[model samples]
Target: MNTPLLELQGLSVHYGSLRALGSIDLVVYPGELVTLLGSNGAGKSTTLRAISALVPAHGQILWRGGSLAGVPAHRLLKLGIGHCPEGRRVLSRQSVVENLMLGAYLRRDTAAIHTDLERCYGLFPRLAERRSQLAGALSGGEQQMLAIARALMGRPELLLLDEPDLGLAPKLVGEVMGALAQLHCEGLTLLLVEQNAEAVLEIADRGYVLEAGQLTLQGPAQELLANPSLRAAYLGG
Candidate 1:
């Protein structure tokens, strides 16, 4: 087995008196796509936030066997971790290209940045078509694509994506999911948090289920997809 690229042990988070995440342990290996599935408010986003250091979390987050404690949120991208947060939080006023440029703000390699910019355009042709348009003017699906492309601009080793497919039509959902699958096939390690369990499970190597901030079930994607209870609760079977 390969050494894990990322690991979480007893990770927990609190928002004032409320615990947003109970202790949860999960692992993702290099070049693998792992999905974290749950309904709304299940701490799926919290998990990704904790890893990105967006929220104060307790316990361990190990990256390539090194402890991530005390690592500041802003530095995570420089450390080869990219986070595409929920809500497609693109700068509404900025042009699409400008938003993507901001994603590589920490990097000095101008040539490579340009290359990655073109790559992102390739990944989302619609983004290429609207490269000069204001991010806010794009449709929901287009904004989601921009958000993912912005994250990819960081050239991360492990990408943490939260709800990339939320609130879109079925056709848009399929388009977004297909892009993710392509990225995974190209060997990008992804830790995705999504409520669309069936779509994600189809591309995931493994999945962990979070229920009200605690893990309730976890296994290979195929097994989880095949489980009757999971099908009923999450897969809409």
Candidate 2:
């Protein structure tokens, strides 16, 4: 068997005195699309933050078997870990292309960066059309597209996405999810944190459910989708 691309062993996180993640264990193998599902305040976002080194954490986080302790948030990108955070954190004032350029700021290889930029444009033609417009001016769906594209500029081996479909209309949600499915089919490894169990289970190979800072359930997508408890809680009673 091959080594997992990422793993969290006994992962724990705290916000002052509050425990946000409690001894969590999870894994994502190379080229697989895995999802972490939970309701709001279930610590879904905190798990991603911890993995990205955005906040202080405890326990062992291994990327390709190397420790992530003491690794700062900014350096994770260079290590092939790219985070497309929740709430579409694209620079509100910057042009779409400018935002993408920021994603590639640390790279010395200009040619590859340019190539990746074109690839991003290819993945999202709307972005190409609004390439010169302020990112905030685009519609919500477009902003989400730009967010994904910017992260792609990093050319990551593992991409962590939080709430990719939050607050979008049903149609826009399908569009964003479709884009993610396309990327996953193209062999990108992803760890997706989402509340829409129905949407992610369709694309993810496996999933883990978190509840109030603890992992509650995990299994292959099909099993999770059909799980009575999961269906009742996330799908619709």
Candidate 3:
């Protein structure tokens, strides 16, 4: 078996006295798309944040057999982990192009960064159209696209996305999900967190479900999609 590209062993997170995650164990392989599914307040975002070193947490985050303990978030980005945070936190005052450029701040490869910028534009043609527009002026869906594109500009070996489909119309959700599917096909490893289980499961290789900061179920995506209880609880069967 191939070594896991990312692994969490007994991972837990606390906000003061409150536990946000409870000893969750998960693995994501290189070149695979894995989805973390859950409803609101389920620690889905906390899981991504902890892996990105954005929050204090307990246990180990292993990347390619090495522990990520005490690593700063910027260093983690340089080591090839990119995070597209929830809420489309683009720089509102900056031009769309500028936000994308910032994503490559840690890289010295000017030529490759330029190439990736163009590639991001290609992936989301609307971004190409509004490349010079201020990010705040764009619609919610467009901002989400820009957030994903910005993450792509980092050229990460493993991309961690948090709720890329939140608060968008159905059509926009399809567009965002389709772009993610394309990215995975083009050999980007993705750890996607979403409440939209049905959409993500259709594209993901494997999935893990979280409930109130604890993992409740995990399996191959299709199997989870087919499981009777899962279908009833999350899939609305």
Per-residue alpha-carbon lDDT of model 2 for 36-78, expressed as tens digits?
Answer: 9999999999999999988888899999999988989988988
Q: Rank the candidates by lDDT, best first.
A: 3, 1, 2
* Local distance difference test values of all predictions, in order: 0.94, 0.94, 0.95
Q: In candidate 2, what residue range of length 10 has the lowest lDDT sum?
A: 1-10
lDDT (Cα, 0-100) at 234 in candidate 2: 96
lDDT value for model 2: 0.94
As a TM-score, model 3 comes out at: 0.98
lDDT tens digits by residue: candidate 3, 1-237: 599999999999999999999999999999999999998999999999999999999999999999999999889888899999999999999999999999888889999999999999989999999999999999999999999999888889999999999999999999999999999999999999999999999999999999999999999999999989888888899
Off by over 4 Å in 3: none
Could you estimate the TM-score for every candidate? 0.98, 0.97, 0.98
Clashes of each: 0, 0, 0
Candidate 1 runs further than 4 Å off: none
Q: By the lDDT metric, which is better: model 1 or model 3?
A: 3
Candidate 2: residue pairs that collide: none
What is the number of residue pairs that collide in model 1? Answer: 0
Ranking by TM-score: 3, 1, 2
Report how far residue 223 has shifted in candidate 3, in Å.
Answer: 0.6
